[model samples]
Target: MEMIVHNPTEGIYAATDDFVHAIEVRSPSRFLFIAGTMGLDSDGVPGTTLEEQLELIWANLRVILAEAGMSVDNIVRLTSYLRDPSYAEANAKARVAALGGRRVPTTAIVAQTLASGWLVEIEVVAAG
Candidate 1:
């Protein structure tokens, strides 16, 4: 009764089902884009370690998703931009932890991010 596209390229998902709920539902609640999630905590403090950064980022994203009335189960894709490529392996490990070590979302990797001294950045796309 529904179609799911796991991280389709071209910035769009072509599903025909009526969206029941979405992160940003306009006409239909199909694809939703979560903003770039960084290490910044809800209290506005940045994490100093990669592990801490990953935790903060995912936590912040969970809050954002909740505000949109969506959950991590709706996340279909993930784009990860890391400050240092050297930390890629560590980041991946952290990601596994964030995802509860299961249901790894469709993921892409980038070597650099926009902020200065930032270790990692993650953005999510969800379907509803």
Candidate 2:
């Protein structure tokens, strides 16, 4: 499979011949796309800190991957949104601790909450 990232103003998939400008992901197995996830827990409340929120997101990711008989190692890509882009370094450290490496999905860092007072939203794609 392949992954394509396009500029919003380029009329959808109007990729230029500059292949190097697009990020492509390919694997020999299945492709998985996860729904956007928020900081709220299974109990429906925000996690305590940025680290705590990342932990919950990681847990949720595990459950989702397990339900499909896979794990984070099979993940090919991930996309995350943060309420504050300035927190990226901290979030990255937390994510590294969770994934045991610094492998990040083709990601974007934005500063806006999906819901008021929320700090992060994460979605992922995996293949192996």
Please give each candidate's TM-score: 0.69, 0.73
For candidate 1, write residues 1-128 as lDDT tens digits: 14433434456764322221223323445667987788987777788888888888888888988888887776656778877777767777766666665443445466656566578888988767
lDDT of 1 at 13: 64
Q: Give per-residue CA lDDT, model 2, range 37-93, as digits (tens).
A: 776789879887887788888888889899998887766667778888776777667
List candidate 1 segments past 4 Å from native.
1-28
Q: What's the residue-level lDDT of 19 in candidate 1?
A: 25
The most accurate candidate by lDDT is 2
Instruction: Give the winner by TM-score.
Output: 2
RMSD of candidate 2 to the truth, in angstroms, is 6.8
Error of 2 at 108 (Å): 3.0
Give the C-alpha miss distance for residue 14 in model 2, angstroms: 26
Worst 10 residues of 1 by lDDT: 16-25
